[model samples]
Target chain A: MNITLAQARQVVAGALAAGRAASYKPLTVVVLDSGGHVVAVEREDGASTKRFEIAHAKAHGAVALGLGSRALMARAEQQPYFIAAVTQTVGALVPVPGGVLVRDADGGLLGAVGVTGDTSDHDELAALAGIEAAGLVGQPD
Target chain B: MNITLAQARQVVAGALAAGRAASYKPLTVVVLDSGGHVVAVEREDGASTKRFEIAHAKAHGAVALGLGSRALMARAEQQPYFIAAVTQTVGALVPVPGGVLVRDADGGLLGAVGVTGDTSDHDELAALAGIEAAGLVGQPD
Candidate 1:
């Protein structure tokens, strides 16, 4: 199922709020629809200049692969060269821990959310929190 | 000036509606901030898979240079080497007719809008309509 535009904004809002509430470093968040196209993106005022691109790359990686970046990392351990090849050739993804897939109740992917500008674990925490706040299921790594 | 997420979405909504009202081909629209980062993008159902990238490239080109793609095209005629250098080095822009800059009433640059999946003229028309609908100005090329 495709994610609505409203849902995409909600994910950004949720993720950013989580970052703020936790007093994490400033962040940038991105939401992508099922087709791996960006739906929405936002960068906090204090976020690093590179935050948005990193967030976008993470979200793209998640949606393009139909799996969370965490899962991809595990897979990458088994095939590092393949992951490297995909990133180098396509320039479409950055398999990392900050990307999370959003799914419908039936486990059908709706899209993905990505967070950047913090530790990988913190970024993942924010993304997962956003998914839950939006009442969407986030698949476990 | 900056384009708010709400304004970005309104532009997409307006452009897509204009496409439908005119019975144009399915389209994909993208909005980018002055920083050349995407604010939002949407591909209408039935749009070609390639439309999103085209739209994004168009928008990126517009904002990066602070000129509409039409203007860029004209400049490209005189400076093909410059355009080639930019494409090869940055890999972020596609200077072409469907991209337009968005501005505030004071002519402050906000960002840009790009549309794809139709003739370039039609794509530009839709982008202008969207800019007007969002209460912003579109700098005509």
Candidate 2:
């Protein structure tokens, strides 16, 4: 399944909203389709220039491996070699939290959402909230 | 040693033939010379968009490291950090089973082949088959 640009934009908005509510730092969010192609991305004011890459990579890795970044983080710890090789294979992969897989009600993969700027846990919370705002499911593990 | 244009074409043909014979998914093939320059590439219909980059990286890594991707996979298991560092330095390396180095009769390096679309084992099989069709030896270990 593919994520519509409108939905991606909504996800971004929701993430930003959640960030603001939590008084988190400036955030960057990236949404990518199942093919790992970016659909929408945004960097809030004060976010570093590298935030985009970091966000995109987190989302890209989630879609590329069909697993959330949180799961990847666990795998990275248990099997560092496999995760490292996969990071190279996928071109960009950050084995950390904040990269969540977006799914439909049927559990079908739609896309991925990546959030950066705040702590990894906060980023992940924002991403999940965003996915919820889009009426979608967020799989962080 | 150099792999001639004709030989490269032959390799592509053989790889495609093998894929078709096995009724595998649409495939992408990349042939690279010893210097890691692309000599030939083909993407079958319905292949995913990222197949080219994935295939190229596999082949490029094989030739760049002077070892088949399968061997790289093993090395990655033993030395995760080292492999990750090398991947970063090389800029493109996928330590997977689809990359195979091509060699001449006297064990002189000719080039490398990368295949994607099916399982990694199947991809490597196609690459080896292609090398053989070109009358070259395949070093996949």
Candidate 3:
């Protein structure tokens, strides 16, 4: 399933809107194409400056591995040695939560999204809103 | 203008929690001190592998310039030549929106937070939430 840049941008916009409505705080959002290239980005005022890179990295990890950051974190816990080795081999493997895979209506891989700040759960919530806005399905809770 | 490691951890944890509650795919959150040093990090399940680096880069940009990533993006657009030169000078510079700066109640710089995955706007929201949870103010929204 091809993920259109337009859809990704919509998702990001929706997520930001949701955050604002909830008064959750400023946020940084990122969208990546299926190929892991950055499609769009947004950084709210009052947000930290590093959020852009962090969001991209998280999205990149999801798109590259076809898995969420949470799963990677679990794997790291189960196999610290392997995770460490992989970390060394792959200079950019971040086993953190907040990265999610974007799937089309038919469950085909479309792209990925990453968010940071607030709680992981909150970040996830904003992402979920964005995915829904994009007419995509996120992994089950 | 000093950011403590404890504050960094708090920001990350809060961001992670927010993401989880929202049922986002997964994520990685990171906090950096004013000096652009990593103070805390967390990776959740299903998050992307590259989030670590992205987070670092985003936060680095915020701290380095004392501006939000979105502002930086504007600058990049207005002066692509200068941005290109800056990127070349700083190998890790990514002038995208998603990073935010953290400040104290008195408006003193504390550090920055970077997030990845969903969208730049979403990432910024999560970071803002984390900063608020840490009892600090994000820059003016």
Query: What is the i-RMS of every prediction?
Result: 3.6, 3.0, 11.5
User: For model 2, what is the error of residue B115's alpha carbon versus the real structure, in angstroms, after optimal superposition?
Assistant: 2.6
Residue B1 in model 1: lDDT:
58
Q: Rank the candidates by lDDT, best first.
A: 2, 1, 3
TM-score for all predictions? 0.77, 0.71, 0.53
RMSD of 1: 3.7
Chain A fold similarity by TM-score, each prediction: 0.93, 0.97, 0.88
Descending-DockQ candidate ranking:
1, 2, 3
CA error at residue B67 for candidate 3, angstroms: 15
Q: TM-score winner among the candidates?
A: 1
Q: DockQ of each model against the real complex?
A: 0.28, 0.26, 0.06
Question: Which candidate achieves the best lDDT against the true structure?
Answer: 2
lDDT of 3 by residue, B72-122 (tens): 778667644334433433336566765888888888788878887767777
Q: Could you tell me how far off, in angstroms, the CA of residue A8 lies in candidate 1 after the best superposition?
A: 4.4
In candidate 2, what are the lDDT values of residues A1-141, reduced to their tens digit?
Answer: 799999999999999999999999999999999888899999999998899999998898887666789988997886676567666666788989999999899987888999999999999999999999999999998
Model 1 residue B31 lDDT score = 83
For A36-137, candidate 3 gives per-residue lDDT tens digits of: 877888988766555676667666667766788677667655775654565455435445666788898788888888876665567778888999988888
**What fraction of correct interface contacts does each candidate retain?**
0.24, 0.35, 0.07
Please list the residue runs of candidate 3 whose C-alpha ends up more than 4 Å from where it truly belongs after superposition.
B1-105, B108-141
Per-model CA lDDT versus the true structure = 0.82, 0.89, 0.73
Could you tell me which residue pairs clash in candidate 1? none
